[model samples]
Target: MKTVKTHITQLLHAMNMGIFEKEHPIALSLLSAISGESIFFLGPPGVAKSLIARRLKLAFDQSTAFEYLMSRFSTPDEIFGPVSISKLKDEDKYERIIEGYLPSATIVFLDEIWKAGPSIQNSLLTVINEKVYRNGQYTIQLPLKGLIAASNELPAQGEGLEALWDRFLIRYFIGNIEQEFAFDQMIASVNDMEAEIPTGLSITEKQYIDWRTQISQIKIHYTVFELIHSIKRQIEKYNIQKEEVPHSTLYISDRRWKKIVSLLRTSAFLNETDTIRFSDCTLLLHCLWNEIEQIPIIEQMVSSALDECISHYLCGERTLEQKLSSIREDMKSEHSLRETKDPALQIVDTFYHQIERYPVAGNLLIFASDYQSLQKDTQKLFYVQRDKYRPVNWILKVYDHVRNRNISQSAIVSLKKGTRSVFINNQEYPLACNAGYDIAYPQEASLLFEFRFQEVIDLYHNRESE
Candidate 1:
C-alpha cells in the first residue's frame, strides 16, 4: 500500500513539474483518472498542459494513451478514421475497423480541443460520457481509463462549444511565473549539474486493473455529497456573466461533476481508504472553483473552503493538538521571556535600532546571534533578513497596520517559542511551525510578517555549529 501510494505521489509530482511547474493539476488529474473519466486542461499554449497527459501515458501501461491536436480543419474522419473501406463495401457492423483517434486508447489527449469542428467535438462527447464512440451506426466500446484535453479559450461566447466543454470533469489553468522568480529558477536549474530522477517505479497492467477495481468499489459518504452540492450553489449564486465569470464554471458539466466526485472516492481508495472523506470533496471543490473567472478571489475562496473542511472534518481534534504542542514548547521556553528591570521593551528597541545600522545580512546575523530564543529552550533561534527568512509556520502578525504603499515601514510581530500570543481583529492566534505569514500589503516590496520554527533554526544552527 505504501509503495503504491508513493508511486502515485511521485507520478503526480512529476506531472505537476512538467505542467505549470506546480502540483495542483497533477492532483486534479489523478483524481480525475481514478474515476475512469477524462479531464480538461484550460490554459494557454506552452504551459506543458499537454505534457502532463503525455507523462501519464509513460507512467502507466505504454501503447495505451493516444493523442490528437484538434484544429478547425479537423474532420470526423481524422478522428474516427475513414469508415473501414471493406466494412463500407460490405456494410458489415462486425468488421474490425481501425480504431478512431480516441476509442482504442486508454488515455487520450486532445490538444486545442475547442477548435475542433462540431462533428468531431460531438463524436468526443460520446467517448467521454459513455466510454464509447459511434461511427456510421457502428457503436464501439472503449477501454478508456481517462482523457485529458487542452484549450486556450474556456467556455465563453464560442461557436456552440459548451457541449464540447462539458465533457471534461477536471479543468485547470497554467499560468506564467513572475520575471524575477523565473530568472532565479532558470539560473539555479542551469547550475544544478547533479539533478536526478528520484525513483524507477513504473505502473503495470495488473496495477491498472487493481486500481480500477478498488476505485469502483470505493464509497462516498453522504456528507461529502452535501458539501459538493453546497459548492455548486455558491457558483450559481454568483451568476457570473460570460465576461466576468470564472472560466471554471464554463468548462464543467453535470456528468463531469458526478465523475469528479467518483474520482475523489477513487483517490481515497488508492490512498488505501475504503470511504471517501469530506477532505477529498474539498480538494475537488478547490479544483472545480479554479475554473471560475476571477482567479485570485476564486483561489482564496477555494483555500478557505478547503482549510475549513480540513479543520472540521478530516482532523478536527488535530488542530487543537497542534496548538497544544506549541503551548507545551512555549512552557519549556518560559524562561526566555523573562522580566528584566532594565526594561525588555528598551532592549527590544535597541535591538531594532542595531538591526537598521548594518547591511541587511549583518543585521540578520547580529539579531539572530544575540536575542532569538525558543519556547523549549531548544536552542532554536529566529531572525529577519532583507530578502527573506527561512521557511516556518509561525504567524507573524503586523502590529499598527501600515496603510503605506511601502512594506518596509510596516511593523510586524514575529512569533517564537516564548513569544506572547497575538490578536488579529480581537481573536487570539497562535504561531505555527515551519511556515511564514506575509503581512505586507499585496503591493509591498518586502515581507512584513515572517515565521520560522525549530527545523529551520536547526538548519542554520547546524551549519554554524559545523
Candidate 2:
C-alpha cells in the first residue's frame, strides 16, 4: 500500500507542476482510476485535463492508451476502427479492426464526447457501462482499467445523454489557475524535461489485482457506512422536494454508492489503516455534489459531522495535549470577548446608571400622594415603550417594596403571552422585552466536560506513576 501510494503521489506531483490549480481534479481522476470507475472532466479547454489523464496512464507500466477528440461528424470507424477487409472477404463476417482503437487500449480518453453521433454514443455506452465491445459475432471483454471523458459543457436534456453522463460516477471541473504564484511557476517550468515513469515504484498487473482483492476485504467502519447511507436518504428526500421547484438533486445509484465504498477502502489502504476513518469522509463532498452550488453546502455538513466525531474522541481521551489545546482555544475566545464591545452590556450599564440617580431613590414613598408621584415619574423615565409602561412600572414597584419591607424573595421565570414573567411570592412581574433575551454558547458544553477532562488527566497520571 505504501509503495502504491508513493508512486501515485509522485505521478500527481509531476503532473501538477506544469498544471496549475488542478490538484483536486487530478486527485479525483486518480482515485476514480484506482476504483476502476470512469470520471469526466467538465470545463473549458486549456486546463490540462488531457495532461492529467495521460499522467494517470503513465502510472501503470506498458498501459496502452487511445486518445481522441470527438465531434458531430465523427463516426464509429474513427473511434472503434475501420472494417476488417480481409476477414469480411474471406470469412464473410463484419468486424472492426481493433488493433489500435479504443478496444485495444487500457486507458481511454475521449474529448468532446457529447458531440458524438448516435452510433458512437451507443457503442460507447456498451464499452464503458458493460466493459464489452461487440464486433459482428464476437463480444470481446475489454481490458480497460479506466475511461476518462472530457467536454466543454454538460449535454442538453433532450439529447438522450443522461445514461452516459451518469456512468462517469465521478465528475470534476478543470479550471484555469488564477493564483499569481502557481501561474508563474507553471509558466517558468522547463519545457524539455521528459516525464519519468517511476518504473521502480510502479505496480504490475498482478500487484494491481492484489490491491483490488485487498480492498474487497477491507473493513469499512460502521460510522462510515452510516454516514453514506444517510446521505443517500437525503438525496432521495431532496429529489422529492425538487418536484415543485425543478432543481438538480442528488441522483446517485445504489451501484454507485457501493462503488464509492471502494474509493474509501482505497483511501484507508493507502493510509495503512484497517478501517476507514472520519478523514476518509471528506471525499464524499466531492462524490455527493452534482452541481457547483451544492459543493459548499455538502462540504460544510461533512466537515461538521467530522468535527463532531473528533470532539467526541477528544472528550474521551487521556491526552494532556488535547486538553491544553482546548483550554488555550477557550482562553483566546475569552480574551476576544473581553476586548470586544457588547451591545447588551452597554444597555445594562446605561439602564443602571440612569435609574440610580432618581430623586426618589432611598425612599419607599408609602403615602398615597408620594406613591402616585413615584409611579408617574418611574413610568415616564423607565418605560419600555410609549404606550406599554404598566409592566415596567409594576416591576419597579415590586423591587422597591421588596427592598423597603426587607422580605425574602425567590424568582420563578415563566413565559406569559410571549412575554417573560418573573414570579416572586406568587406575584407575577413581566420582565422588560429586551432584558430577557441573551445568547448561549452551547459549544461550551457546561462544566460537565471539565469534570470528565479532569478525571481523564488523573487517570493518566496514576497510570504513568504506576
Winner by TM-score: 2
lDDT of 2 by residue, 167-196 (tens): 777777778888999888878887834456
Best by lDDT: 2
The alpha-carbon lDDT assigned to residue 235 of candidate 1 equals 60
What local distance difference test score does each model get? 0.54, 0.63
CA lDDT of 249 in candidate 1?
50
The digit string of per-residue lDDT tens for model 1 on 344-422 reads: 1122222221222222233222222122332323332222324234332121212222111123533232433323222
Q: How many backbone clashes are present in model 2? A: 0
After superposition, the stretches of candidate 2 with alpha carbons farther than 4 Å from their true spots are: 15-17, 189-193, 304-466
Error of 2 at 29 (Å): 1.9
lDDT of 2: 0.63
